[model samples]
Target chain A: MSIKNFILFLFLTAILWVVTIFGQSNNPTLMSQWIFDAYNKKEQTAKKIKGKKVIVVAGSNALFGIDSKILSSYFKLPVVNDGVNAGIYLPLILEISKRIINKGDIVLAPLEPNMYSYNHKVGVQVIDYLFARKPLFFWDLSFKEQFYILWHIEFERIWKGYNYRGGSPLTAGFYGAFNIDQNGDQINTSLKFKNQGMFKDLERHHKNPEHYGAEFSTEALGWDYLEKFVSWCNKRDVKVIFVPATLMKHPSYFNDPIEKEFYDKKIIDEVKKRGWTFIGKPHNYMYDSSFYFNTNFHLTQKGKIMRTRQLIKDLKSSLKK
Target chain B: MLFNTYQFIFIFLIPTVIIYLSIPREFKIKFLILVSTIFYSLWSVEHLLILLSSIIINYFLARKLENSILNQRFLLFAIISLNLLPLIYYKYSLFLTFSESSPILPLAISFFTFQQIAFQFDIYKKKQQVKSFEEYLFFILFFPQLVAGPIVHYKELIPQTKEKNWGEYQKDYFNMGIILFSIGLFKKVVLADNLAPIANYAFANIETISNYDAWLGIFAYTFQIYFDFSGYSDMAIGLALFFGIKLPINFNSPYKARNIIEFWRNWHITLSNFLRDHIYIPLGGNRVTLPKQAINILITMAIGGIWHGSGWTFIIWGILHGLILIISHRFNWFKIPSPIAIFLTFFSVLLLWVIFRADNLSDALSYYTILFNFQAIPINIEFNEILLLSCSIIIFFLPNSLSISQYLKAKPKLHWYHSLFVAILFFIALKTLALAPAQTFVYFNF
Candidate 1:
């Protein structure tokens, strides 16, 4: 091959790549649309709610694990579940939380334990999908940050996105955005039963128990963003409460006192140092493995009720003070 | 720093190549050494320092050995030991102490150490002359083969360095390099990585997996390692070609070998050559009695396995190969029908690879038990079966990168269709690379 032919080959490849990306960005898959719909619904609920309300902010753990309706009924205030995928990373999640929160509102944060140490840049998949729906959010980032995220986006994802032929979000059944209730919680009763695949996943974790649990570190970027979020809430007179995300009670963690104490001390000390109001002991929310739906964090319907009742008790005690 | 990554390809390689092509002939070698230093340092600065120290120490020792007369043998032994010290400390400390605590290994310590040792041995035997310090440094620190190597010889590369005409046949070499590199990248990203999940799933669930999944896992791994290492070798050779230097061919379709002896000759050919010339010949190779030859083969193969890693599994893997070689030497397996002999050889290799890939002996044993259990349970895990079958076909039927390169060289010129095919392959591989995190070459751990 001559140099001219080789350059022509490269030119052809560049054109194909650009075409794939453009096609995929214009045609959003059902999964991406579902994510966008869920976000839009939660944002609208947070905006339209009259006066001070209880804002529940977290990852999918809160979306699937919490019953905001129960919290609203007990506290006699409107509530909105502003939870999304954890792959969006904590910094952006907290930034999104700011739009929902208002002065004199109570902000309930049940962050997943791993969120404490999620210091890496946002993943390519999340950025690609979210940027198509919410270009403003991506444009808001600094040029360097935008480039870092863009550099990681793979051509495979664009090709897959372009090839996706699934129907719209409305037809996605139980796992679709339409399943989300008015209070911003996923309330599909078909997901009440435990998934069998979860057992295999849990078995793998059982073999390597140390892989579970939160990796908390003060030096992490998550901590810096979290501290800033608390300060933002303080200045606005919005109350912030930090609570543990619900988790399956694996014997490896709950049975060993030393392991249990290690995590307990880490969470309590970090929360105290930040001067955020932490309600409920970390162990209080850990339920048996049967309560889990599919992942270690997501809860079944009955499990969600149990977790909510515990949260209600903790909130009742802390709100009185 | 891996070749498959965006940062390495776009940020490092493309820029480095353009700059290298534009530089004057005299400065090209020096420029490469500087860039290669930066490349290694990007992976780790501390490890780069260790590499430099080894190069400086080995270069000086080689020069001394070439000039010295008294205690030449002792000096050679000392030089070899000094070259091996860092490798032993970083790689074998856990095995030696039988303790849990072990230090992180310095990258490429094993490859560079072995290369330097070969240089010293050749110097002592008066088979090699000491070159300029800069040439020696460039030979050692050349980034393409610095980490996982074809275990290059001093003679093969040094003479090429001295012929410094940048313009002659530059376009031809660059074009060939692009083709070889694209093929390598496709094999690694599209084939090897896709097979990894199935193998990993079965190995992670050894006790519970059925006989069907066990066989699938073993086959997946068999082809995975072959494509992974061979693809890496092709990329290394291709990158060297970009600078108008040719590297020794490291793989030549070892899966097609009809016997264990043939397998050794084809697989990891450079390492096999090193063991043959340096270790086997010195230990009274095949000129001795049958029993002594067997012992010599066993010792050489055992050292070969130990060189790969510090595990008992690696030692056992090595010894098993030695036993097979002995059997191949004694019996008339080659007299059997060609198809059956090839099948038998491939089966034996696939079995041994389990021990090589396992975390420990117990896992390997359990995996073997599962493989022969004869249970008919269904495969539960989700994997692309089509991809596995495709990889198998490619391994058995494909002409390999070297053959393809030779075929292209025979042609007067590449047609437009060839360029289009190459472009599509390259684009597909790049897209696949973007789909997941880049997996390191399996040989890099050695």
Candidate 2:
């Protein structure tokens, strides 16, 4: 083959690659589509609610952790849990929350610790979610971010998405869109108190309390976007209350008081400085491992009730002040 | 710094190739040596120093062996020992002492050390000579084949450095290199890496895995090691072709061989040849009594095994192969039907690979027990079944990379479809690389 022909071959391949990226971008997978459907349902619910509603926003921790119906009854107002997968980009989550939150609404953010320290780089999950829920949002991204997404998109995911037979969100069972209630809280009975062996192993492995929690950085990419979200809420006269995500109460945290104090101080100081109404201490929300469903963050059905009662108590105290 | 990485391809290879091709022909070899040094340094400057020191010491000692007459045999032994010193210190000291900690093994120490020893041996035997310091350096330090090699000899590579009319063949070589490299990259990133998870999961969960899962893991590894090593070898040869240098084909569909001897002949051919010439032949290969020859084979194979790693499993894997080779030699297995013979040989190899892949003898034994325990438990582990099937089909029915390269070489004219096929292969491999962390070639540890 001539050098010219070789270059031509390379040119042809580059064209095919670009074509593939565009082609795959339009076709989202069943999992992402299901997540998108849940988002749409939650957005509709938030829109339906009238006057002084409560909007619970975070990652999956908030979805499984909060009892929005109980909170709605307690506050004498509609409550919408707008939390989804934490793996989604933090900024994108905040942006999604921005659309649902209204004037005079209270925003309860019990975000996962890791969310505060998220690196701004685009990951596969973020690409999948954005492509499914709001592809136009992808165009709004910087060229570097888009390139990062396209580069990291696996052939397996694309192939699976292409070959995926159309299925209802119910096919996803426990974590399906169907499991999410009218207020966007995940309420599957099967996930009530199932013993997760993996969490046991995780607990054993993370005996040192030092391994837990994110290293709080005020200048983190997450914090910058979070500040923007708070500003957006503040502009609309929407009250923002920052609370810690529900955590497993490991004994090591009690043993290592210094590490515990450091962990609490970093987050509390940041939240206070940001002018968000910081509610209940993180340690107060740390329940026994039995309260956790699978991961350390997610709560079981009974655990969610306990967490909601605690949140209500914390809110009552703050609102009274 | 691995051939499979984006940084190696984009930063190191492309720039180096552009500079190399544009340079004057007389300066090309020197330029390659410099780039090769840079490549090694990128891996570790300390290791590069170790490599350079080895080259200098071996080169001077080789010259001494070539010139000195009175104590020639003593000097040759001394040179060989001196060459083995660093390899032993870095690679085998922990094994020798049964200790927990040891100095880091320099990358490709086994490969370059063996190459240097062979060159020294060749010089002593008057079969080869180092014409120039630059030529010798370029031969040993040539980047593509330096780390994981086909173990290029002084004769195969050094003479190629002197060739000047490579400009005429530049396009053909580059095209062929691309095709070969694309195939290799696909095998590595797509096949081997994808299969790695299944094998790793099963091995890591050996105590809990069923008979079916155990077999799946073993088969996954059986094909994984072949694809990983052969893929690396193909990439090396393909990369070398870009520079108009042809490294020897290290693999030739060894799975198709009907016997252990033929398997060895086809698998890692350079290493097998090196063992035969340097170790086996020097130990009175086939010229002695049958028992003595058997002992020779055992000793040679054990060394070959240990050369791969300092682990007892590697040594045992080698000794088992040596025993199998002895049995293969003593009996006329040729009388057996060819299909059955191939199956038997493949089965034996598959079993041996367990020993090779295992971290320890105990794990290997437990794995064997699991394979034969006949426990019919449901398969709990999730793996790419389609990929495993595809790998099997490719291994059994598809033409190996050498055959494909040879076929490409023989073709009179290249067509558009051929380019498209190569392009698609390259594109898929590149995207796969983008999706995951590039896995290290399995043989690099050796």
> What do the candidate models score in CA lDDT, each in turn?
0.82, 0.83
The residue pairs found clashing in candidate 1 are none
| Each prediction's DockQ against the real complex | 0.33, 0.46
lDDT of 1 by residue, B46-122 (tens): 88889999999999889899999999999999998888888888999899994577788888888999899888889
The 10-residue segment with the lowest total lDDT in model 2 chain B: B376-385
User: What are the candidates' C-alpha RMSDs?
Assistant: 7.1, 3.8
Off by over 4 Å in 1: A17-185, A188-321, B98-100, B164-169, B332-334, B377-382
Mind giving the per-residue lDDT tens digits that candidate 1 earns over A65-169?
889989899989998988866667776788877877899998999987777766656776466565455555666565655655554566546655767776355
Model 1 collision count: 0
| Candidate 2 error regions (>4 Å) | A2-30, A33-41, A69-76, A119-124, A171-173, A176-182, A186-243, A248-291, A300-321, B98-100, B166-169, B330-337, B375-383
